[model samples]
Target chain A: MRKSTAPIISIADVKNVLGKQVVHEHLNLDIMKGEITAIVGGSGCGKTTLLRNILMLLRPKSGSIKIFDIDILHCDIKTSQKIRHSWGVLFQHGALFSALTVLENVQFPLRTFTTLPPKVQKEIALLKITMSGLPLEAAFKYPSELSGGMLKRAALARAIVMDPELLFLDEPTSGLDPQSAGAFDELLLDLKEGLGLTVVMVTHDLSSLAHVSDKVVFLGEKKVLAALPLQELLKQKHPLIQAYFSGSRGESYVKSA
Target chain B: MNNQQPAQLSFDKNTHTLHCSGSWTVSAISDFLKQPPLTTNKTNRIQIEGGGISRMDTTGAWALHQQANALKKSGKTISFSGFSEEHTALFQMVEAALPEKQPRPKSSRKPSFLYVLGKKSVDRYFSLLNGLAFLGEVIVFFGRIIMRPARLQYKSFLNVIDETGYRAIAIVGLLSFLIGIVLAYQSGQQLKTYGANIYIISLIGIAMLQEFGPLITAIIVAGRTSSAFTAQIGTMQLNEEIDALRTMGVSPVIRLVIPKILGLIISLPLLIILADICGVLGGMLVADKMLNISYYSFLLNFPNMIQLQTLLNGLIKGPFFACIIAGVGCYQGFQVVSSADSVGRKTTKSVVQSIFLIIVADALFSIILPWQSV
Candidate 1:
């Protein structure tokens, strides 16, 4: 995504403290509208923590997070909830509610966030399930019964059920076979085009970074090192960043890009 | 943008044309599908004019595609005009993503009621045999450990003792004291009628040592330790930690199950001993208050009335009860399927099954042993 003057999501001077350790200090980031942005970093670099902060699941020690230009840090509960409805999140390992069937899991957000009748919610959920590349029979199966790939698809269906403008995906292609991962990238790109979603994904899959992400954000040194297009990120001078994009997988990804 | 103008459809009879107008999105789908001006017969050779459409999305596209499919089913020619490039692409994408019909396998034949009954009975029988097989495996594992004492997980055994033993002391003591007081008071009332108030010591001592102490302690442990064991192992199973352990060449039975079994087996007898002492002390207190029997006289008569044989009978039942509780707890843990709800159900089942088995074992012991001989 291009760096637009008006950002759909903005983070400024973010400070995140975990016990005596500091995860992020004076971190600033922006996500443009209708762009697929991938956050990549090494272990212990707090990529997941940043995603959690943006999702409002974790509160930063100090920061200003604005979604749709509204300051979320100081916003009242009702206002914050209203803003939350404009975005959807998919967690790593699909974090699906194991107690609910695929249909119920997809319908969960609509039930909580909308006053729509059950029948309409069901219809929308079924449509989203099909869109997420799941079969009709998968609707009734429990999360426990689903394979890893199917779980991710079911979770994705739930995430997009409300047609939120911003979609947050955490390690979306992790644990999937290469074919399934490639198929998942295609699905992400398809959703971005067809639904005009501004997607923020945290992933380490270089191929996904190459194919799906319009822009890539590299994190190191307790903060974002760079936020640039995938091609530009590859040419970065930072040793860690260079090493990250120099692996065999990275070479394949660059060739594909 | 006008509300009346939105979703308005006009069919020209002369041209056989359908004019679509307004917001043809998710919100307008109900109205568009429920009230279409084009009749089923008139839809033949249908021409959809999309120029009047103010907005359309994937949902709208899907709805229109479904309508087109219906028209095709009726042998009608359909065409869309004035749809923007974006809308056209989205429509085609959604149409391509539609789920394909799959053929479900049919059951060859419905089983007769007798067959179902026989099948259920066979399943139940196999499950019983499976439980026996599990017991055999546990016994074999125990024998192997006995032959090689160095293989025991001492740290895990100690941890289980801390959890199921030391932590359980307070509740076991409290319940045993209360049971003793109830027993002493109730028996003392009837014995007073016969001027045999001193016999209250014998009643409470014999009952506590031979029956209530071990039985009550086992039941409490079943509710406490059994449920904990099931939930802990069941959650580990759900998280694939067991699979991880297996891949690392760790025997779950030796590393996980045996330690728990050893902990409960060692702790239960010690708990029963504490319970017996507390119970006897409680009876003495109640005997002094309710029966006007002095504590001095109660202590003097207690050993004479409660024989070593009587105390030994209850203590002997401890390890058996422990085995049942621990075995049932771990067995139910293994039975847990994937999901958080299964953990809760298996925990409940563990407690229920352990207590049931303990009671059954105690009953058999009582029937075979001579309690009346004391």
Candidate 2:
């Protein structure tokens, strides 16, 4: 990652959640323009909470978040919408339209964000569907008919339908089989190179972090513990990192890595 | 390696045994009901083999009773021969609690078709009367529209026109033509006996303008446009698209419901007009060909039978039917639960309820219109 490429996303001294309970506090992070970052942690470590905060889905009680050098908190509604359009999100469970065919699901963002004609819209949807490694035959089938893997691919197709600059994937490989998950990692790598996308993925899938992530952020101890390359993460003396990397849970991942 | 397959169950020339296994619960009762019936040969007797039965509950006893009932239905002897002591005790307890089946008395009188129709009419009379409740909802919806005109968006009006009006042209036209032909054939047959076959034009023209034109068009719109709106909105709700719209600072009612209501309101009258023309043309074609009536005389009589009040009545029904369609469609869509099956159920209900409301509204109009004029 080039240091000269000023951070596209910067979270500064953020404290989030309300009431007497604080979910996360005193968090500071900077994500570079064109790099893939993986947020990895155990369950209830508030990794998802942090991503939601950055996405402005949740407001911080203190401090600020800047995306593409624009303060997300202070931006007007139109500017916020514009900023959101620039980023694509792949929710857990793929969140594809159960009623719509895969092709229409992929066409959703394109239809919402652009004034492209129906034929052009269809062509763009088909291209993204193809890029996701799903066949043309699967395009007209509903999400219910798709297997878990195909649903993820279709969702990925939708996420990139508008050729978004930043892509956010929450637990992309969580429910996929080992082989399908490996294939998904390869697809993400291909997309990262092909589309020049800056990806921020939240995952418990250690195998994904080892194979695809340029940098991994381990959220622990009420803050981000370390954001480093896989090699560096492996060598770290952090007890939580060591515990996560040295067990039956980490064995398959170590082998894949 | 041994490649032989395991032995399958056999239904020989004697009693057949069905082995029941697994933990039986209320949730699994449906699956248990779907089990294939046991077959037997010369002596059609079904014997339960309960050796492998691991767990039994109230649902299991009910399933056993259902199985026995099926065997009895098939004219076979059924017995629970191999039940464990525990299973036997459970069955006895259940049998004691079961209600006695009442014998249905055979009716001596074979009711006529008209009698059956009259009975159904009586039974459905309350349902027909209860449909008046929808008018209160309609009044409330219109009251909201009038009170908060700003809530109704121009885009929604265009959307409603597109969905209800533009999408329904071909279907309404086709059905209207078919109805016209049927009306011509029936009226021609009647009028021929009196040597007045030319009167088919007046019959079809009056019917189309006053009743069939509005009613048939409304029914078709209910089935097509209302169901589409429900399914579209229901699916959006399921996919959290509606929630997303709310989060993004857009009111779902304004974005979704407004367009559908506007479209249906604008389209229904136009569609009725088109149906009216098509129905008349269909009648004219049949009158000239099948009835050997002169087209010019038929056309001359057609206008004399159709008054401006009749045309206005048909046009007036459009907005009312549109409101009914939109209200029912929006109500059903909002009622959609978070599942694909619920979406389908809501879509079906939207169409059924919309058509039912349309008919009820027509009845009310028929009763009140003469009173209003007086």
Candidate 3:
């Protein structure tokens, strides 16, 4: 692979917890600037941990993580918070604030990070809420009042409220219906191109990987066993890789595509 | 992990032999103390054989000495047949601090259920009762608010008014009207027996304004609004919103609990006053129609029957009961574990516990207040 323009996120020989005993040893990976990358893995594989490490939510026992060339571990709290604000994370559950209305949830990051007037904040919040394809009527309704797909859109609205440069979404479409999941994929693709975001997503949904991912990294057997495009990944000879693509797991991908 | 298993021990009371083996630590001593006494008979002699003891520390020796002393005090003889040199040294150290055992009084009576359950559980129940003892806590919580005059969060205050005060009006109004009708019906029968049916106004006016009106209204609010507060916060906790607030630098107590507490504190008295007025009006309509009493005569005696103390007493319990309801609600909410069922369980517990405490507090207040002098 042509060494992509100076990598935005670089993990050097990272070691992390595997389970009760085993650890992921000496894993090195780099994500380039302004591109969408997908980390795919089977159960017990450490893809989520790697994303967590990159997000600085988890500290590696013995390795360095640099985001935009700044060493995150050694940075002070204020500097770390500044780095965190530049990234948006969509947790697997959507993690929308249940007590807050959809508009309030979307406005949370803005209210915390900016000193903009309330009117401007509301305008910005409504814009993002609308951009996520939710109805204007949803602005006043709480998360408990929303359906599963609407909840995801509300979460996406909150995630983009800060206009984060890096977007990390963990299983964004896992629980949604097929139509909604495909719509969400298109929305991600649109954001990736329009906003020039460096997106790192961990997903079991292969259909999404094929549809939008610029690069795919397969984590298994305690390392990044393969890093290739979704199309090429299907042809790989690794038994685990072949099993994943040939089984019920890959059926959703083929059917959706 | 290899050393984590506990060594076994058994005592044959019929044979008067105590068998033991273990590396006994303080934790092991505590575990031993948790068991029932070895012998039931006060005069039974006991023998402890420590030959199988692999490792004995000071704590183990201390435990042994205590057991021996307890046995001796119960009018029984205790003999230690085998002891390692280390164990002997520890025994000597423990023996030096302990007082000489004396003959214990024999009891012919059997132990009660409470005794069998042990002091620890008794203490736990007492503590739970103490937590449910809301009169003092209610007084203190309200006293602080009224005396200190802390700068209230106007926005949250208004939010609570919207949630507790306005939302509760319909229910309180409906219930009060029904209670009035019941009161009138019950009193009308008794009053008609004496040909003094006009006195129903005095009965309803005095009773509703003095005691039942405020107490019933406060209890209803505690059941309806306070439990809702707990369930809402408990659900938020289960959903991680409380954690999110903490991570974002918002104090959940001040932002959430204080508002609800203050809102109830402000609204409950007003609700009681409203219930009292509505209840009196309902009573008047029933007495005038059902009892054939003139509305003019009922009104004439109503004012004379109800002193200023009646209204004052009702108003007094409002803030106190409000504090009780709010505090219990928030306490239960904060205690919720990360489960959906915990929300419902805690909400129900908050209402039940709050009402129970409110009544008990009222009883205590009635006994202590100078009502006779007034």
Q: Which candidate is the best by DockQ?
A: 1
Clashes within 3 Å, all models in order: 0, 4, 0
Clash pairs, candidate 1, are: none
Model 2 regions lying over 4 Å from their true place? A1-5, A18-20, B1-341, B344-374
What fraction of the genuine interface contacts, i.e. the true contacts, does candidate 2 reproduce?
Answer: 0.03
Q: How accurate is candidate 1 locally (lDDT)?
A: 0.84
lDDT per residue for candidate 3 within A121-187, as digits (tens), equals 5655666676677777787887777887888888988887676768999888888888888888877
Model 3 residue A19 CA deviation (Å) reads 6.8
| DockQ of each candidate relative to the true complex | 0.39, 0.03, 0.01
The C-alpha stretches of model 1 lying farther than 4 A from their native spots are: A1-4, A110-124, B1-57, B64-84, B100-112
Instruction: Give per-residue CA lDDT, model 2, range A192-243, as digits (tens).
Output: 6544568999998887888899989888877788888888887899999888
What are the per-residue Cα lDDT tens digits for candidate 3 across B276-371? 988887888888789987778877877677677777877888888887888889878876875566687889899999999899988876776555
Of the true interface contacts, each candidate retains a share of: 0.26, 0.03, 0.00
Query: What are the per-residue Cα lDDT tens digits for candidate 1 across B241-355?
Result: 9889999999778888899999998999999998998898889889999899999999888777777889899999999998999999998888788999999999998999999
CAPRI-style quality class for the chain A–B interface of candidate 1: acceptable
Error of 3 at A39 (Å): 1.2
Worst 10 residues of 2 chain B by lDDT: B1-10
RMSD of each: 3.7, 21.7, 25.9
In order, the B-chain TM-scores come to 0.83, 0.61, 0.61
